[model samples]
Target: MTEQDVREVLNGRRAQAARNDGAILDAARTVFLAEPDAPIGAVARAAGVGISALYRRYPSKEALLATLCLDGLRQFVTIAESAREVPDPWEAFVEFLRGIVDADVHSLTVHLAGRFTPTPEHRDLAVRAGALAAEILHRAQQAGVVRNDVEITDLPMIYEQLAAIRLGDATRLRELRRRYLDVHLAGLRTAATSYGAMTGSAPTRAEAGARWNRTT
Candidate 1:
């Protein structure tokens, strides 16, 4: 074959490969978000790609999930950073909490992956996001808006509960979820405090993973 013809063919193949990679990632995100433990074959089917093609791009389900988890973490960091810029610390904290739950609802698989088996990159991103969340939480606490006993780790548990709201019927479900979330947020306010100290230890990653695995 002529050199020019060979070059054209190579470029065509590269474009096809890139398209396949994008399709695989998009499919994985959708399939896994609905069911975090979905099998690799399900993702391949969703991508409309052969199993071999999917395997070529991601050696294992874990590898694909890790990538998704990392992306989700980065998105979360962006949201938290943006919320931090809000003029009112209390508003920023409330918005940050809501944003995390929204993210988890859209990317359930990433949420589960981070808690269960995070890659090194995912872990690093989680740490960064956690630090940002801590800062937002601290600001609210210092403002005497959030309860003094609230811990940073308690944030994930709140998201977890929020995520439990069924989304099968989108419109009605969202309204119900919003109501529940509003009630929960109101409870988090410092004025909601009654008398005694808040009980229980802050949630750990290991415990979070165990709880997630139990549900899935």
Candidate 2:
């Protein structure tokens, strides 16, 4: 083959690999979220890729879980950073909450938390996401957009609650999440007099971190 033809072939192969990788990751999230113990073969079938191809990329289920958790953290950080840039505090807070609901990172945490060991990189990303989220929450509170009773630590639980809505098909689930989120958002904006003050304490950072298996 001519050098140009060989280069074209290599480029095509790379593009196909990228496409396969995206499919595998997306399928992994859907399958694992539904059934955390589902076999890796299920992910392959869901992605419409061969089992060998999935294994070639992920090596093991643990590897796939780690990648999903890490990617979720990256998504959280990206959303928070973008939301923080919005000119309006309330709008920024709403954007951040909506993004979290869509990303559904907490659902991954609910299902996959004790299944794999986290590396130092994972810890760093978690800390960074936490810090960015805290900044966003603080901004909203300072502007009186969010209730003072809300705490930074409350966010994990909020996301977890939203993630628990697993009924219905994809479109239906999306609609339900948004519907419930709007209700929750209104509550966050002001305390209901009948509800009184937010009782009990938010989950401590330690309590949240305790769920994950950080050690190898």
**lDDT (C-alpha, whole model) for all candidates:** 0.78, 0.90
Clashing pairs in 1: none
Highest TM-score: which candidate? 2
Tens digits of per-residue lDDT for model 2 on 35-95? 9889999999999999998888999999999999999999999999999999999999999
Candidate 1 error regions (>4 Å): 1-19, 105-117, 169-173, 204-216
* Local lDDT at 150 for model 2: 89
What TM-score, over all chains together, does every model reach?
Answer: 0.79, 0.92
How far out, in Å, is residue 188 in model 2?
1.5
Lowest lDDT sum, 10 consecutive residues, model 1, at: 105-114
Root-mean-square deviation (CA) per prediction:
3.8, 1.9
Go through the candidates in order and give the clash count of each: 0, 0
